[model samples]
Target: MEEEVENILQKGGELFHPGLSVDCVIFGFHDNQLKVLLLKMKHADKWALPGGFVYKEEEVEHAAVRVLQSRTGLGNIFLRQFHTFGSPSRSDRKLNRELLVSLDLEAHENHWFLQRFITVGYYALVNFSSAVPRPDATSEACAWWDLQDMPPLAMDHNHILQQALETLRKQLNDQPVGYNLLPEKFTMPELQRLYETILGKQLDRRNFQRKMLGYGILDRLEERKRGVAHKAPYLYSFNKEKYAAALQDGLQQGW
Candidate 1:
């Protein structure tokens, strides 16, 4: 594995733009909470957003997709590029020093990685139950972390996460991208909870139902939610045709 990584890095360094990379903020909704996929750095306590350098021939968006797929074992998901972080001080000297010490770096390789980096940030929404997180060469472990319970991250990742969430909040009112984070079948209450979790506020149940149903993108199923203490609500699924139409028409105002 080490030899393979060394070869890949050498090739990538030859063909890819140094000091420019892509970072993915993969968001998931589960257990009435919002979560983000984070990777534990190999031989270190620091965690970082799943990210990778952009190949010289690759478009930034494609690079983001590649990074996401490589780190999370997911492809063709709902991905959106929102921001770029290029602060000169964003470099993590400690992490870089540790990595340099760990790897048998050639002179050229050392020069390549020691410089400043600017990362184009992208965020993806995925069904938590469907996502299979995978660690990349730089990481030892990968797992879902509730947004509130996230551990300290490497570099400017914490800032990147905040920017990603803000972008997501803006998207909620415009794009119907939230469906990517949910199960196939869900109840109004569950749907509302998802919105509330993202928006970070309590929404009136009555008003929430009315606005969501009014979108005309949901198909009410005959089946009801089962095995709950409270009254089982009717199940609903996104009407793909109508959802597409509504996306073209845009949302009726705000949720």
Candidate 2:
């Protein structure tokens, strides 16, 4: 692992952009809870957002997609760039030095990975059950943490996560969001729960149903959820054509 770190830093200049990085806030919805994917560092007890440096030949957006795909093993993810963090002190040299020391490696003053970085923040929405989280060389574990109970993140990651969440909440007013977060067929109550979780509040059920149906993005299936003791709720799925159209041209109403 020490050799691997040395090798990566040695080739960093040839392989990746020096001062630009991409950080992803991958959100997943499960059991009515909102979760974010996080990586636990290999030799340290710190956690961080899944992130990586942009390749020298790659576009920033493509770098974000690549970072997410490598971590989550999911290709078709809904991603949106939210912000750029470029504070001069954003990169914590102290933390970097501690991490390197933990790996039993020493980096010189001119090391590429030790430089100041401007990170582009992107938020991705994926189906909770579809992702197979995998850690990178610097991390030992990749797993989902509930948004309500997330651990302290390294660097400016907590702020980045908050900004991403705020952007997602604002986007809910204009875009269709649940298509990637929910299963192929789901109940209206389930969909409502997803929205409520993201918004951090409870929504009136009847009003939510009316607005969602009026958007014309959902198809009400004849079948209902099975194996429930109470009267089963009717199942619904996104109308792909309408959903795509809605996503292309903003939705008519806001929640």
lDDT of 2 by residue, 1-255 (tens): 567766776688789988889999999999889999999987667899999888888899999999999999999778989999999999988777776667656667877778898999999999889999999888889999999999989999999999999999998889988998999999999999999999999999999999999999999999999998899999999999999899888897644
lDDT of 2 at 202: 93
Q: Residue-wise lDDT of candidate 1 within 150-209, one digit each (tens)?
A: 999988999999999999888778767557788899989889989999898999999988
Per-candidate TM equals: 0.92, 0.95
Clashing pairs in 1: none
TM-score of 1: 0.92
Clash pairs of candidate 2? Answer: none
